[model samples]
Target: MSPVVLFDAALALGVLGCAALALTLRDRTGTVAAFMLTGLLVALSWLRLGAPDVALAEAAIGAGLTGALFLRGARRLGPLRARPPAPAQAAAAALGAAVLSAALLWAFATAPAESLYPPRVAAALEDSGVSNPVTAVLLNFRAWDTLLEIAVLVVALLLVMTLSPPRVIPDKLGALVQPFARIVVPVAVLVAGHLLWQGAEAPGGAFQAGAVLAGAGLALVLGGVRVDRRVLRRALTALALAGLAVFTLAALASQAVTGALLGYPDGQAKAWIIAIEGALTLSIAATLCLLFTGYGRRSAR
Candidate 1:
């Protein structure tokens, strides 16, 4: 086999192995670790498929943030004493998986050889006002979809707040942690800004940039950097809601200006997209951080 094929085979095997390991591991932490590994491998798969944006998202949010959340939950759960599922349940699951796989394969085999959307997108790209096709698609061609996604995040944040999950405070890691945070957090911020700025022309965008910022926030939280709770709460709330609010307002404004929802005026699409993306970056970052931290630390009664 060619080197590329060989590498792909290895990656595919690694993904499957890690996924199986995660499912079967008795230890919660080990299972979470394995799952995270699987996510990273999946991110690599996305890269192999020529989707760097998806890969970045998979690595940052799927693997990094999700793994941290799982780790925190695992620590709280303490011990694992649950019995395994019955044999019948396992058989049913296996049968379901087999059926789904067969159906997907069939669909793929029967599908049209060429997609119609690519040409449509390419034709409309000049008017979309962004050099990056991905950005144009996301922020212009299908902005309604993006709007709904932001709304979903807002709903999730509301749900999290309603449930009021307990906080897991990080233990101090010593003097080294402060120095580490000082260096890493600033760098993460810069990286996030770069990603946001380049997203209109490259693989980086609001989601990826926001996730990076959230990662930095997580580092600070984990590093035991102290902040005033009331102030932090207000700031996070504002930042978390800002993106959706701005997006909504923009949509309305666009409607008023162009007579179509989310439609930008001629020669102004890029400006609208950039403004919306800027707000989204901060909002997504704050929302993710708040979600992971369970809306910040609270005093234990």
Candidate 2:
């Protein structure tokens, strides 16, 4: 077989192996580490599939932030003490997994060789007003879906708030953290901006940009940065809601002008998309940050 095929096979195996290892590991930290490794492998698979946008998201949110969250949960839960699975239960699980794998392989082998949607999307790209096919599809061809996704995020934020989880106070790592944040945080902001702007024509978008900004915020928290709790809370909540509010208002404006929700005027699709994406970036960043740090106020350190 070709080297490329060999590499692909190894990556696929690595993902499966890491996932299984994560599930089998009794130690919480080890399991979290294995899961994060699996996410990185999945991100590589997405890149190999020619979806860099997905790869970026998988790396940032899937591997990075999600791993952090898992670590936090593990810390809170303390040491693992659960007994190993019974031999019979393990055998049954193995049998069930084998059956599911076989079914998936059979479906993949039987799947059609061609799909009709790509050509349709390409044909509509110019009308959608974005050179990037993914962006066009997301912001124009299927905008209602994107709008609903934002609404779902908002709902998730509300649910998280209702729980009133305690704020995350990062353990002091040393003086190096302050210097690290000073250098890294500014770069993260610039990178997020670039990602948001280039998303119109490149493999970057609001989700990726927002995730990066959230990472920066997490870093600031870790570095023991201080800001007034009241102001920070107000700002975060407003920013968290801004995306849905702006998107809804824009949809209404579009309906007024073109008599269809999110239908941009003949010459203004790009503007509409940029405006919507900007709001989404802020909202997504705030929402993710809030989810991580929680809404509880911590006295300034």
Give candidates' CA RMSD values in order: 1.7, 1.8
Give the distance in Å from residue 89's predicted Cα in candidate 1 to where it truly belongs: 2.9
Backbone clash pairs for candidate 2 read none
Candidate 2 local distance difference test against the native: 0.91
Query: Which pairs of residues collide in candidate 1?
Result: none
Give the lDDT of residue 70 in candidate 1.
85
In model 2, the Cα lDDT at residue 219 comes to 94
Question: How many clashing pairs in candidate 2?
Answer: 0
Taking the tens digit of each residue's C-alpha lDDT, what string does model 2 give over 1-301?
9999999999999999999998889889999999999999999999999999989999999999999888878887789888778999989999998999999999999998897899999888988878889889899989999999999999988997887677787777897998899999999999999999999999999999999999998898778788986698779989999999999999999999999999999989999999999999989999998888877544221
Candidate number of the best lDDT = 1
lDDT of 1 by residue, 69-93 (tens): 8888788777788888899998999
Report lDDT (Cα) of residue 3, candidate 1. Answer: 100
